[model samples]
Target: MADEEVWKAIDDLHAWLDANKAVDGPEALLLRVLKLSEEVGEVAQAVIGATGQNPRKGTSHTWDDVRSELCDVVITALVALRTLTPDAREVFATHLAGVTERSLDGRTP
Candidate 1:
C-alpha cells in the first residue's frame, strides 16, 4: 500500500475508535502506546517459532507468519502515533527521511 493510503486507513480506524469511545484520554493513550510492545512481542514469538529456536516448540510458525506479525507491529505503532498526534504521516516521513539520509549517506544503498 502507498504511504497515504496507510495513513488514511489509520485515520479511519482512529475515527471509528473515537466514535466508539475506545480512546478517551491519558489512560487510553498509555494503553495505545503499550500496544506496540505487545505487537512487538508477537513478532519476536513468530520469529522464534519460524527459526525453531525453541526446541520444545519447533517449527511452530512459518516465515510468512513472522512477516504478518511484523506488519501488525507497524500498524499498531502507526495507530499509536496517530493517537498521539494528527500529523503522524508527516512526522513519520520526516523521521524516515532523516534516517534514510544518514544510513545511505545521500547515495542509493
Candidate 2:
C-alpha cells in the first residue's frame, strides 16, 4: 500500500507534467538544474538573511525563497536521469524496491 501510493503519486505528477509539458528531457533537465541551483542559492540567502548576515553585495534570501530551489533540484535530477535512461521509471522502481527490502531486513542495499 505504501509503495502503491508512491507510484501513484509519481504517476499523478507525470500526468500533470504531460499536461503541462513541463518535464521534457535534456533541455528540460538543464533548465530544471539551473532553476534548482538558483533556488538552493536562495535558500542559502535565506539562511544568511535569517542570521542577519549580509552576504557580500546582492546576495541574500529567506527560507521560503530557497525551498523552491531545492524542489527544483529534485525535479531536474529526475528529468535528467529520465533523459538518459529512457526507462527511468523502471530504474527508480527497481532501486526503491531494493532499498525497501534492504531496509526491511535491516541492512544496507
Candidate 3:
C-alpha cells in the first residue's frame, strides 16, 4: 500500500482507539507510547520462538510470525506518534529521509 493509505489507516485506528479508551489526555498518550514497548517485546518473543532459542518452546513461531510482530511494532509506533501530533505522516517522512540520507551518504549501494 501507499504511504498515504498507511497514514490514513493509522489515523483511523487512532481515532477508534481514542473513542474506546477509558483514559484521555496525557494519560492516554502515555499509555499509547507504552504500547509500543509491548509490541516491541512481542517482536522479540516472536524472533526467539522462530529461532527456537527457548528450549521449552522449540520453534513455536515461524518467520512469518516475526514479520507480523514487527509490523505490529511499526503500527503501534505510528499510532503513538499520531497520538502525540496530528502531523505524524510528515514527521515520520522527514525523519526517515534524514536517516536514509545519513545511512547512505549519497551512495546508491
Candidate 4:
C-alpha cells in the first residue's frame, strides 16, 4: 500500500483504539511513545532469532520475520506520531526530508 493509505489506516485504527478505551489523553500519549520501545525490542528479538544468536534456540525466525518486526516498529511509531498530531504525514515527511538531507550530504535517501 501507499504511504497515504497506510497513514489513513493507522488513523482509523487510532480512532477505533480511542473508542474502545485503549488509549487517551496525556498518559495515553506517553504510553504510545513507550510502546515504540516494546516494538523495538521485538525487532531485536526477531533479528536474534533469525541470526540464531542464541545457542539454545537456533534459526527460529527467518529474515522475513525480522522485516515484519521492523514493520511493526514503524507502525507503532506512526501511531504514536498520530497521537501527538493530526498532521503526522506532513510532519514525518518534513522531518524525513531534513534527516535525509543532513545525513546524506544533501542527497535524497
Model 3 residue 106 lDDT score: 70
| 10-87 per-residue lDDT for model 1 (tens digits) | 999877766776656888889878988999999999999999999999999999999999999888888888988999
* Global Cα RMSD, each model: 1.6, 5.6, 1.1, 1.5
Q: Model 4: runs farther than 4 Å from truth?
A: none
- What is residue 65's positional error in candidate 2, in angstroms? 1.7
Candidate ranking (lDDT, best to worst): 3, 1, 4, 2
Each prediction's total of clashing residue pairs, residues at least 3 apart in sequence or on different chains, is 0, 5, 0, 0
Put down candidate 2 lDDT per residue, 6-94, tens digits, no spaces. Answer: 44555665556556766566676566456556666666766676566774644455566557666655655565455446576789878
The best candidate by lDDT is 3
Which model is ahead, 3 or 4, in terms of lDDT? 3
Rank the models by TM-score, top first: 3, 4, 1, 2
TM-score of 3: 0.94
The all-Cα superposition gives candidate 2 an RMSD in Å to the true structure of 5.6
Better of 1 and 2 by lDDT: 1
Global lDDT of model 1: 0.89
By TM-score, is 1 or 4 better? 4
lDDT score for candidate 2 against the true structure: 0.62
- TM-score of every prediction relative to native: 0.89, 0.46, 0.94, 0.90
Predictions in order: lDDT: 0.89, 0.62, 0.93, 0.87
2 against 3, candidate with superior TM-score:
3
